[model samples]
Target: MSYVGWMIFGVVLLVIEILTPTFFFLWFSIAAFLSGILAMFGLNLGWQVSVFAVASTLLVIFTRPIAKKIMGEAPRKVYVEELKNGVATVVQDIDSSKGTGIVKISGENWRALSVDPKKVIKKGEEVVIERIEGTTVYVRPIETEAKKEGEEI
Candidate 1:
């Protein structure tokens, strides 16, 4: 293949990579680019194809694991749906006047605040998670929530 052909192949592969982004096309795109560079240096057609296959194979074998590790889904992030209406332990007094506190929800410490602005929750209290916005968990006193649920039943 001519230099221009290799370059076009590389560009097309890159575009496919952008469209799909499953890490499948990335190696091929890099290989195609390297092959194009080799073609520009007047390498033989057979050698160009060989370089492409070898480089692509090496890239997938070596870099794919590193990419997966770096992008690994470790611990993962908790969404609002996971925490809303859940229970939490107040680790620090939640003083709405000061606008800050801490709680342990699902074994993770999170900044917390009372759902009612005037409510002040003391440390060591169990609270019901009302909602979560950003890193803050808005909560209500557990007893009150329990009472309300009991009344509803």
Candidate 2:
């Protein structure tokens, strides 16, 4: 292809890199730009393609690790087990039969279910996380002194 064609291909690859940044295509785009430069200097098709392949491989090998370190690690996965026994406030009434509830714990909201499905946990009440199954937390109401005394009675 002509130098113009290679340049246009480079630009297209660069646009793709910007849209879905995985650091993989950026190297190829740089290689494409390099190939375009070689084409401008009157290199034939075989030489341009060989240069593109070698340049892309070298860029990925030498630069990808540095780029990743500069960008930082991917987002950490939050495990529900870590939040076990943590206190949460009911944001929506929990009724297992109706499959409806929301709770706020440590500034994040999560779907919740009562440990005792028959017991309806009201909004604004505090609960202790008993366990988590999948994305929904199973919680039991926090036992207050008044409730303990009432229970004894």
Candidate 3:
């Protein structure tokens, strides 16, 4: 292809890169622009193609990881101890059989359910929060904690 063809491809690629950035095609667009420059200097078409391929590959290999580190997803971490064994008061009856309940912990109301399917926790009862799953608190009655202490899970 002519230098004008390469230049057109380069501009189109750049436009696409701007619209939806992946930190990927921008490098190839740069290679296309460079190939156009080489073509403008009267380099053979074969050399221009080779240059575009090598430059695009090298840029991706060297810079893609750096860009990903700068832009990659940062996942929020959850600590188990922050929720485990925390004491909570049942604000509404927790009937695991019906898959419903409510509790209050640290003055905040929360949807709750018993870990044991057969268990039903009564309102106003203090229960130990075994764990939190999303917005729901899984708990067991504190009175049942002795023989099942920690096994309150």
Which candidate number has the best lDDT? Answer: 2
* Winner by lDDT between candidate 2 and candidate 1: 2
TM-score of each: 0.49, 0.56, 0.48
How many residue-pair clashes does candidate 3 contain?
0
Candidate 2, 41-143: lDDT as tens digits: 9999999999999999999999999999988998777777789999999999999989999999888899999989899999999999999988899999999
State the weakest 10-residue window (summed lDDT) of model 2: 73-82
Task: Candidate 2: list runs displaced more than 4 Å.
Answer: 1-63, 73-76, 149-153
Model 1 lDDT per residue over 6-93, tens place: 9999999999989973677989999999999999999999999999999999999999988777766556777779788999999999
Better of 1 and 3 by TM-score: 1
Among the numbered candidates, top TM-score falls to 2
What are the Cα lDDT values of the candidates?
0.90, 0.94, 0.88
lDDT of 3 by residue, 1-153 (tens): 889999999999999998985888899999999999999999999999999999999999999999989987755554546767999888889998888898988777889989897988889889998888888888988776465666665
Worst 10 residues of 3 by lDDT: 74-83
Where does candidate 1 stray beyond 4 Å? 1-61, 64-73, 144-153
Clashes per prediction?
A: 0, 0, 0
Assess candidate 1 and give its lDDT.
0.90
Q: Which lDDT value does model 3 have at 80?
A: 47
TM-score-wise, the better of 1 and 2 is 2
